[model samples]
Target: MIPEPIPEPRDAESEAQPLDAYSQAVSAVARELTPRVASLRVRQRGREGSGSAVTFTADGFLLTNAHVVGGARGGQAAFADGTTTSFNVVGTDPLSDLAVVRADGDTPGPVTLGDSDGLVVGQLVVAVGNPLGLAGSVTAGVVSALGRSLPTRSGNAVRVIEDVIQTDAALNPGNSGGALADSRGHVVGINTAVAGIGLGLAVPINSTSRRIIGALMRDGRVRRAFLGLVANPVPVPAALRERLGQRDALRVADVVPASPAARAGLRRGDLVLTAGGVPVSQAQSLQRLMFAEAIGRPLQITVLRNGAMVDVIAEPTELDAEHA
Candidate 1:
């Protein structure tokens, strides 16, 4: 066989400019997701506010930030293609900063939701939303961190949103309630808050958030089980970890008087290792287990105390509005 001829390399002048890997990924996602984002015009208490929303269902349900709709009964959702229609608030969960709105007329079509739990730090992400009243704006960045906790207050009840997605994507006030998409164009998070320059947070679209969204759509509200306890993450000792198969645990910092934990004889300095027979390493895990369905139910919580394990039964109560 004849020897293969060497191919000549093309000159720089003759070669076409190529986009980088990140640019290509973002461009592809933006093209598929921009059309699904909606610019919200909310009028509440004689004041008009603007933000972004994403259609979460085919029958005209939209997901947005509760702060964006602030006391607004109805609003207009303007799509990128100029389709504007009136939408009424179905429910609002201020503790999670999520709200559901239903369009009076046509729907913008729902977006493909991704598993935020699968996201890793340094993963590429694209944000699509209406920022500062600009429709269909797109921004790209990498996930800066994970497992962030955001504090939210609804009336006198203060709660923490766990597993919040933190990114470096440039976000403005109007970007709240927008879609944070993965490389495959699936929405992994709902943009929620901006901390500082180059820092943004989104509510992860995990099982917990999905439950809240479903409750909002069906019951017009999310009713959660209240467990009056404040805890912080602490490392479990090697001996205790081997016994419980848990490396870290939540240390009880406070127990409200007459609360479920208090009534169950849980005290401060106790390290919580399991709830409802499942291992729990974060406060959010306990919160997730305390859904509305669990109200008035006996929950078995195992704790590590003084190098020993003890089990207690807590009767969770319905979370009232002022304390949810």
Candidate 2:
């Protein structure tokens, strides 16, 4: 058999083109976001902690994780442009792990907030933050998954921050509250946790979070409606699934004693089909309805109990921040 001829070496520039494009994308995102992200140093109850924050408003408002500035009166923020400012904590919602602050000094223009609901798996994302106390650090990665849940608690109230973005971006100790931007440099999520090596989690920027941010900015706190029930998603019965055009419903796992759910006759093992006339499929489906508007409002809920349809009216109460 004749020996195969050797193939010519591939062109170097062509070989590196893909990597160079990726580098350019990451570089552009970093340059656009670094100046808007700040290294934060906060003191709470005489204990100091450090993290990162992102400028989200033209009038010096910044957004960060609630845990970052927990019970702190104010903090110092240092930007990548060599400018430093003092910021006062506006509000903190521990259930969502989101907080807002206003800088006492000038700040860079706010980064564009993108809809995290539009992000898809495998999409390119760039993380800009002060990881390890090093300012202006940038890391690139693809979204590994979507709709992950991060459980949170405030006093006796336990909730899940839903639709969290999961990525493989390299995050570290100081990366919390940083910007997780998309390819076009829109802030899609806020880096919140390092789940493991190469696994990072972000609180998605969506309508629900927007409401929380707005409440924080205006009221210094988030007011939530309390239903007082624990639920999980479950497959809907075949007959009802076809009729409702939905595959899943929320299964009531527990109901707090004397709570609105219990008062409204909602019980464990009930499959919730709709709340306030909207289809209920996941915990978030019910959570999204538990905002300020839902408080004190009569909510009509439909459920499947013992293979029969049951309707109940629940009047949710305003969740007390101190007791929640």
Give all candidates' CA lDDT scores: 0.84, 0.87
Best by TM-score: 1
- The 10-residue segment with the lowest total lDDT in model 1: 153-162
Best by lDDT: 2
Q: Estimate candidate 2's RMSD in Å.
A: 5.9
Evaluate model 1: give its lDDT: 0.84
Question: Which residue pairs collide, candidate 2?
Answer: none
lDDT of 2 by residue, 1-324 (tens): 999999988887868745588888998999899889999999877788989999999999999998899889898999987889999999998767899999999999999999987888899999999753577888999999776666555566555555578899988789999999999999999999887899999998988899899999999999888887777777898877778899988888777777899999999999999999999786668879988889999999999999999999999998765425
What tens digits encode model 1's per-residue C-alpha lDDT throughout 228-273? 7777667888866686678877888777667788999999999989
TM-score, one value per model: 0.83, 0.80
Colliding residue pairs in candidate 1: none
